[model samples]
Target: MKLLLVVSNYPYEGHPYSGAFNERSALALRRLGHEVEVLAPRPYVPRGLSRLASRWSSYASIPEHETRAEIAVYRPAYAQLPLLGGALWSESCAYAVSAGEIARRHRRAPYDAILSFGLIGAGGIGWRLGRRLAVPAAGWATGNDVRVAPRSSFGKAVRRSLEKIDLVFYQSAELRACGAALLNVAPDEMDARRHAVLPRGVEEPPVLSSERRHELRRAVGLGEEQVVVLYLGRIAAPKGVFELAQAMARARERCPELICWMVGAKRGFDDSAKLARCGSVRLIDACAHEQIWDYFAAADIFAFPSHGEGMPNSLLEAMSTGLPAVAYAIPPIEEIDQGSGALLRVAPGDVHGLADALVSLARTPERRAALGRNGRARVYAAFLSADRMASAARRVAQLIETRGVSFSQFADRSAAAVRR
Candidate 1:
């Protein structure tokens, strides 16, 4: 099947890590023998005048089109309103700009399906574009897209788009339900027969031996007997970075050997100032995507206090590396809540509870080891690789086959969308 994938964020020349997960999904599809073309919208300014332009000028250096790992990617610059975090209307303008580009490209080689990597920004765009192309359109709801956007104007747009969209590709059942509520869809009607779950997956983790673990720790300047508790993701308020810093101070009081190492970039929230107060914490400004696992190797536990998530690549990668996770008890993380006692979860915003969980794991090596093993086993059994997500193309093809292909079905779906 041929796919025209529209994503709001994707890795560019200056930002190799912008949307690594989306890139991984594309590569996985390519590996699985599918023809995929990417239409990723980037905010940019003129190159020579970029320095004098707004904050979004950082992307000015990236070429509009490039190929990585043999996959064609089209990065079109769209007008953006700087500093308006969730400026709903800005996304519509961006979508209009990207939709024009996709339509232009469609004239040369028609695609079999259309899917958006993000729900709000790209999903709404896909809905509009799909109606024009008369093909299947689907959206993916990651953590912030559904969990955080509901009740906002963007949420309403997503809700309306959900009614029109032919399918919703989700990360978890919890997130799928959230999308249903946003769409005002009845619970019983929300099914795989309509919606599907595509949990984030990881490449098989590199083998780590006792000596390799010791070497990785020494390389990272970790001392012997010191337990490393790692947090890797965008530094955001909802991620509970500030609470994590406070929890580290409290947990260290019980297990003096415990140290918190936060490795991520300043996306929206920069808790570097708050984290400065904790002397036992270590900071590594976002490392390269290829090098993240080494930090996991140097760690004893992966303690992520994130309040909500679609399906965390960090949690999946860390678990694949055999690192036990202590995260917030959110619906999306429910599947990983393995009945085999794999994960330790605390309620969101419970700093003290996070500290206690950290302390318990730190003081008991056997318990940590057992949970880590269990977590690794669970990840392998379920989310083994991104290749699993590549099946999205097949699902889209199936939808096109079962629901719509000719003018009559397209007109029917299009009219239904108009009524919604």
Candidate 2:
């Protein structure tokens, strides 16, 4: 099957971590023996330009082509300020325009189906294109789109887009329900039969030698015998960075040798500096995705006290590296289960509970190691192996080919029945 995968974000030189999960899914689909072409609208901001000139130059600047994991990828230019309002509008318009061009070019050899990620921005484009081309369209809903955006006008527009798509993929049951609710559609209308829980995947990281681990510890000013807790990803409020800091401080008082290393970028360094005053926390600027494995391998544990998520890729990466995770027991986090790692009941802003969990993990190395091994096993069985996802994609493709129904058609039929 020939598939056109559309998304607003893609891995680029400056933002390699961006849209990696989408890229991984595309790779898995290709590995399933399907031909895949990624249609991405590369966003650009020209510096000190004649505004119109800047937009034109930025659009022209995008590479016409690229390859990722043996799949052909094309990036068309889109002029959008990265600000919230303009970005959303720009993405919708750019995708609609670019997708039409793609349809025209491939008119003689039309794509078998279209798969899109995100609802408000990317879904509008896919729905318009699929309607134009008379092909099946599927949309994947990320956590923020469902949980955070629904209260806004843009979010309502996204719900309309979802209503027009054939299938909505979610990472968890809660998210699926949220999507259905936002659309004001019955849960059954958003049937799990068509929907799927497709969590992200990660490659196993390289095994670090004891010497390498010790070297990393020394470089970070952590003692060889200390229990090092590592936090990898953005250091934002939603990420529970402040809570993690408090937890580290508490853990330090109990186990003086416990060290916390935060390896990620921060919008502000002031918070990190405040945490450093506790004398047990250190913050390093973000590391390359390729280099993240070493930090996981070197650390005794991975701690993320984030409040909400849609199956975070970082958790999977940590598990793949046999690093035990201590995270807040949010809906997506519960997917890890007891067999995978420790899930603590820390409310979104519960600093004390977060700190206590860290201390407990630090004191119990044997339990931590066991948890890490279990997490690795769980990841291999359920998340890391892309075979199940490939099977699901193939099944969806087969349905699209056999039914010959556009997503909007299915949605309209379903909605009509509901009204009747």
Candidate 3:
């Protein structure tokens, strides 16, 4: 099946981590024997060559179009105001840019369905593009779209876009419910069947052998005797980094061998100093995209105290690497971490509870091994494997094909029902 994926934020020149999850999904779909193209909009700042111009010159220089990972990707320029609801504005510009590409692609072969990520911006763009092309559009909801948007500046606009889309894909059950509340359409209009509850996939990372693990540890000057705990995402508030630090500070009293290898950064900012006071925590600088797997391999356990998440991709990666995790028993986190017995989850903000859990896990290496194995098995059996995600995508394509040239009938009736 041929697809046109529209996203507002995607990995571009000099930005390695941006929209990486979306890019991986695209590649996974292609691996399943489908053709995919990307339409990612870049922020444009028009100025009289001022300081902003000097700062954003790299964005303008980003290649307008490039084909990477065996997929054709296009980055169109969209003028945006950062602070105040730029997402809505980006969609309008994206629609204009996407229409031309859709037309060009349609001439070669019509896409089975249009796929868009990020419900706030790209969802509207995909809905508009689908309307123009008279095809079904599926919006993938993640992070800010479900969590931040409803409470943000453009709540109603986001809701309207969700209402208009033919289908919605949510990475977690929490997000699915959050979307319904945010969209707030009547039962008759918000058809649950139209939403696909598909968590993002875990592409098998480079398998780290026991020898490789030792090599990575030695390279980082970590002694073979120490227990390395890893926090994969941003080192910021809400991620509970400070709380994790406190937890470590307490846990170290019980097991002084515990050393946290803080990897990744907050928007590429290394506030490693935040955890400086924690004697047991080691502030490792953010690694390159390719170097992440080595950190996972080098670590003995994954500790994520994040208060919230949209499926926790980093957690998934760590789990797939066969590392036992200790995180919060929060929604979505609990959804993934529960029942498997692979994770030890404490209450959301209980530092002592978190510390106790970590110390217990650290002391019991046999239990850790058992949990790690179970976590890896869970990822392979139920979570997002490449084939699982591809299969979900294929099902959506099949649905669109059977639904015929347009999903306008469904959209119209739902809108009317919502109105009445």
Candidate 4:
């Protein structure tokens, strides 16, 4: 089938780490023998007054372009001025304009289906464009859309759009619950038959021999005997970086040989000073996505004390590489089960509990090794393989073909049925 994949945040040459999950899904679709195209709305600041507003805020402009990846890509330009107390009126306007462009293009070459990522402006834009082109459109929701946006007016608009899409692809049960709550629909009315839990898959990394592992360790300045706990991703607050630092500090008191290597860029949250103060923690600025496997192989264990997430790709990648994980036992994470790794009950701000878990894991090498092996086995059997995700996508597409109505229409009907 011919498909159009839409998203605002896609990885370009300039930003290779951006929107990796969506890229993985699109690649998976292509592997399943479907012709796919990408439409990314490039957000930019407007000229003059809008540029000033963007300098102050960053919602004043949008840009557009086209590229070829594993599939054809289109990046439409639009204005996104942040005004009226940080509203996204420019984003809405950009979507309307881009949707018109997409419609015009589709008239020349029609697509069988439209798949969108994000629940806010991007999903809404995809829905509008699909309607104009008379094609089935599905939206994939991650953590921010469900967990972060609900507190804002933009979130309300996104919720309405969620109720209007053809299908909803949620990565976790928590996200599904958030959608149901936002739409004021019953939990059961969320339509699990149409909605699917499809986490992105990780490619099999090159097998790292013991020599390669040791070489990588030396290159990264980690000693052979040190028990390295690795954290790979953006160093942000919701990621629990500060909590991980506090945990490492406590663990160091017990296991002096333990080392924590944080390999990611600093973006959302600031914890550099806190981590620096800890003698055992080492922060590596950021590595290429392709080079992530080396870090995973060099580490003894993976530590992700995240407070919020939607099936973090980092954890899956670590597990695929046979690294044991010690993470906060949140809902999306709870899906990891106990066999793969140790899931500790560390609430968002519970630094003490996080510290204790790290300390416990640091002292038990046998437990760590066992968990690591189990995690690898679990990833291979359940999550890392792309076949399951492709099957789920196919099922969602088939549901749209059979139902004759969009996912949002079905959700609305389901909501009404619940009320009756």
Whole-model Cα lDDT of every candidate shown, in order: 0.77, 0.71, 0.76, 0.71
Alpha carbon deviation, residue 316, candidate 4 (Å)? 1.1
Candidate 1 ranges with C-alpha deviation above 4 Å:
44-55, 83-91, 148-151, 267-269, 403-420
Candidate closer to the true structure by TM-score (higher is better), 3 or 4:
3
Score every model by TM-score. Answer: 0.88, 0.84, 0.89, 0.86
**Candidate 4 accuracy as lDDT:** 0.71
Candidate 3 per-residue lDDT, tens place, 8-98, comes to 6667656666678888888888888888998888777655442344435556766788988778888877776655555556767657755
Q: Write the per-residue lDDT of candidate 1 for residues 251-336, one digit (tens) a residue.
A: 88889989888888553336665665667677778766788878888889998888777887788889888899998887767777
Model 3 regions more than 4 Å off = 47-58, 149-153, 185-190, 266-280, 408-420
Q: In TM-score terms, which candidate is top? A: 3
lDDT of 4 by residue, 302-359 (tens): 8888888887778888887777777777787778664344333456567777777677
Query: What ranges in model 2 sit over 4 Å off?
Result: 44-64, 81-88, 148-151, 186-189, 204-222, 266-280, 338-345, 405-420
TM-score of 4: 0.86
What TM-score does model 2 achieve against the real structure? 0.84
Query: 88, model 2: CA deviation in Å?
Result: 5.7
| Candidate 2, poorest ten consecutive residues by summed lDDT | 411-420
Report the CA-based lDDT of candidate 3 relative to the real structure: 0.76
